[model samples]
Target: MKKLITLAAIALFSTASFAQTTWNVDKAHSKLQFTITHLAVSDVDGIFKDFTATIVSSKPDFSDAKVSMTANTASVSTDNDQRDGHLKSPDFFDAAAFPTLTFVSTGITKTSANHYKLNGILTLHGTAKAVVFELWYRGTITNPMSKADDAGFQVTGTIKRSDFGFGSKYGSPMLSDEVVVKANGEFSKAN
Candidate 1:
């Protein structure tokens, strides 16, 4: 009877291990980008050159998942050198003080096949606030060269810049308060 109980315990542990898999962000195939209105007319675009995301899920459908990401604020670039420098200064992100922005998932709800609603807390410029994003799981593929599983995803969200202590000096008429954020990434199953 003791031997039988030990076998059962081993089975349970094995099942749990088989149920979950962790994936590592493929930085070369991922991008984090944002767009904000400029002069209330045109749009200014920027991308964070340095960032990392860790994803773990219990199933292929991703019904239960944990996701988190950290991005370097000083890496923000908007094409023009002067504007990029200003964005990293105190009047804007103050990247020197708050070098990174982070997002941690609080909940993940599967809306349908390939679609999900992701709720999380975004910490930017030393402030943390709840934000919801729409995500699309683009399915997984096996890499031919590496012989590993790779998962792809696309995400879209919008946040009020003012809520994150951004753009107060040139408010509304000159610069819109809303900022649109987007991401497209591929993750490789960690060995």
Candidate 2:
């Protein structure tokens, strides 16, 4: 009887582990943006036009969700052609040398209902650093058009550009060392 009970418990644990679900970001409804204080007088904003993100979890509340994202460095745009070109050059992102920036969650801690502190490793400009972002799970709903279960989320954080070894020439009043990052996405359940 004890052996049979042990086998049942093991089977239940294995089934729960295999129940992980994956959600893929809907690019049409997502945006990855950043802002930096420029000259201490104005703020400059930009967006990565090419990016992909996913979430994997087994819990209904997504407390155990693991997030991953990758953004194309060359796709950074501030709506100004000259500035965008410069950003892609050796001065800032040096997109040719570092083609992509990626983030993979190491862990997540629930801070409150539908809110979490997401700890992850962010790799930029060939440097990887541990960072934490505030994540808000905006809940899930069935998409009227797609008729699929979709989840919404928003992540916000700040990072020092200097830590990643980028934009060292610009300092203080020229540009702020801190960059504000924000991402919003609608993810559809893949399975």
TM-score of each: 0.92, 0.92
Q: Which regions of candidate 1 fall more than 4 Å away from where they truly are?
A: 1-14
CA lDDT for candidate 2: 0.96
lDDT of 1 by residue, 1-191 (tens): 99999999999998986687888899999999999898889999999999999888988877777889999999998889999999999888899999999999999998999899999999999999999999899999999989999999888999998998876787888888999999999999998
lDDT measured at residue 12 in model 1 versus the true structure, 0 to 100? 94
- Which residue segments of model 2 deviate by more than 4 Å? 1-18
**Per-residue lDDT over 1-191 for candidate 2, one digit per residue giving the tens place of the 0 to 100 score:** 99999999999998987698999999999999999999999999999999999999999899999999999999999999999999999888899999999999999999999999999999999999999999999999999998999999999999999999888889867999999999999999996
lDDT minimum window of 10 residues, candidate 1? 58-67
Error of 1 at 167 (Å): 2.0
For candidate 1, the per-residue lDDT at 28 reads 97
The worst-scoring run of ten residues by lDDT in candidate 2 lies at 164-173
lDDT of each: 0.91, 0.96
